[model samples]
Target: MTTDAETAVFEEHRPVLMGVAYRMLGRVADAEDVVQEAWLRWSAADRAGVREPPAYLVRITTRLAIDRLRQVKARGEAYVGPWLPEPYATDFGDTVPDTEERAVLADSVSLAVLVVLESLSPLERAVFVLREAFGYPYAEIATMLDRGEPAVRQLAGRARRHVDERRPRYDVDPAQRRDLTERFLAAAAEGDLAGLMDLLAPDVRLVGDSGGKAQAPLRILESADNVGRFLVAVGGKSVPDMSFRFLELNGGPAVLVLSGGMPDSVFQVDVSAGRISSVYVLRNPDKLRSLASA
Candidate 1:
């Protein structure tokens, strides 16, 4: 038997759990499933003797997410192409009510960071998310993972170092990112190679996710010239007229444009020293399904 207060507590913690699962899994659908399962476990629990519902629910969600990550890892080995995180069509305001908060949230959720996260082992990823993203104390995190405090700290430190090395530093000013994105989009859409080069950094890399449903570079393309040429070649073809809608992505400005009346793709811009350092174009139709549904 449950009291009204207990039910309310569970509901209050749902978003936090969803956020945790989303960061851990890098896919909204999978995160939702994990959270749903957490709810089921919570509801089935004997509430009378239980205390600290928030921590209890978080433990359930974290464990379920780790198990799911193991399964996802095996699945990725046989995936069709370069795996990309699923995109969500969440309202920026709803997710991050504060303007400053939106930028931080967007940068954190960036596809590049999520991709880097994929490289981490399951425990490493969990430790990083719980500590870095959610600000969980090491003692609490250690208990959640059933590990000693020292071991948990080491795991989080290792994950942080790995991420710091691979992940580009992000600037989260929405207006600035939005402006840069616009310039990049306009340059690409018009097939202006020079303009594109001007906006792209010297070491710019372009990662495309087509999932074999559309044409994309099978591997990551390095160098500004190569990325520019590829963009020109692709843009020359007849592409659906897309409306560029800037949205908060991975704690930064991202474009979620609609083509043919569906969510076509997401573009993540990595800006460094006022130039776009990298551009990630996710065109995998399957990955875009959630964004479409949103």
Candidate 2:
């Protein structure tokens, strides 16, 4: 292939590569870095020997992400509070028309799932991302990881079991989630404690990630009462100039609060049985910086 042809091939698969990397690492910056490294490697590779471009690119991105994830884990950076994945803008556009496939993608990247994935071994995470999120065959995954097919299968099984055991169940219907999310934001913004309580599940859990750079609960808040009151109290203390914009993020509707035209925080809810079962707040300034530019 000529230079333009090679570039076109890389660009065509960029989204899939990004999706794989992001799912593997759970941080946008790190995922992008991994993808860039994959591009460099791809561009320098002997293209004539590469018959399957998509698989080759995915393998490169996944390995790079595994390396990045290992480095991040080694850093031992203490999280200020509940650590949530950096909110990613997920717009499937016209490419993903299948409902079930989209749901799989969304659930795989949800905050709760990503948090659970953080506990997985790097190889396990890579297997899960490839087999679960992207539906790669065990043979293909084994080749990508340079491991035996049986070992890859085992890794996939273990990762799937772990994720299935920990990932919270939520309704996947976008319309239902959007409706509840809108009501959720309205209730919190108005300081309507009763309204907020009504929307929360009895055992609803709230996890706020602030990284100690902003005001947020330093511990997880559980139960409808506790989460509701905390939200109302925080709302009461919020400055008058705060504003919120509703947008689809991480495959669902989310509230983006802007303070003076800058991203201040993000609020997203997980609805189960038509009530909010979990609420995630991202207040870490480092995490919000990316959204500010969006």
Candidate 3:
């Protein structure tokens, strides 16, 4: 392929490469950096011997992400407060034709699952993303990671079990989730404690990620009463100029709170049995910068 053709090939496979990178490292900027590095490598590598561009590109992207993830772990940077994955816009558009596959992909990228994935070893995380999220067979995944099939399968099993045990199961209905989110936000904003309590499950949990840079509960809030009371009290004290809007984020509907036209925070709920089971709040200023552009 000529230079132009090679560039086109990389661009053609960019989406898949990006998807792999983002799944591997929950941060958007990190994912983009890894993908860019992959492109640099791809552009300079010997393409004459490359027969499968997609597989080769994915391998590069995944490996780059793994390296980056390890570096992040090694840095041991102390986050300001509860950390939340940067709210990502994950609209797959019309490219993903299968509903079931899309749901699986969405769940794999969810904040809950991503948090659990953080506990996993880098290699296990890679295997889980490739095998569970992308449905790559063990043999193919082994080739991508330069590991034996048995080893890949073992990683997959261990990762899957870890995630399953940690991630709170939730219903995956988009329509239902959207509706519940809308109602939950309305109740909170209006300081309707009764309404908010009604929407919350008895054992609903609230996880706030203000990273100590902002005002949020440093500890997780459990039970409908505690979560509901905290939200109502906080909602009552919100700035007079505060406002909110709904948008699809991280594969589901989310409420982006704004104060004087600036991003204040993000509120996303996980629903189970038609009630809000858990609420994820992203309030760290660093995490909200992308919202300005998003």
In terms of lDDT, the best-performing candidate is 2
* C-alpha TM-scores of all predictions: 0.90, 0.97, 0.96
What is the C-alpha local distance difference test score of candidate 2?
0.91
**What is the RMSD, in Å, between candidate 3 and the native fold over all Cα?**
1.4
Top-scoring candidate (TM-score): 2
> What pairs collide in candidate 1?
106-250, 106-251, 106-252, 107-250, 107-251, 107-252, 109-250, 110-250
Model 1 Cα lDDT, one tens digit per residue, 1-294: 657877788899998898789889988889999999998888889876667788888989999999999998878656555777776444455755766555545555677788899899999999988887677899999988899999998999899999999987755555676788998888887999999999888898888888788777888899999999998887787758766677755566677878876887788787778888888888887777767644
Superposed by TM-score, candidate 2 places the C-alpha of residue 129 at a distance from the truth, in angstroms, of: 0.5
Clash pairs (backbone) in predicted model 2: none
Model 3 lDDT per residue over 1-294, tens place: 349989999999898888888888888889989999999999889999999998999899988999999999999888765677888888888989899999988998899988888899999999999998889889989999999999999999999999989999899999999999999988998899999989999999999998888889898999999999999998888575887888888789999988888899999999999999999998888888888856
lDDT of 3: 0.90
Query: Measured by C-alpha RMSD in angstroms, how accurate is candidate 1?
Result: 2.4
List the candidate 1 regions with Cα displacement exceeding 4 Å: 1-5, 89-104
**Model 3: how far residue 219 lies from native, Å:** 1.0
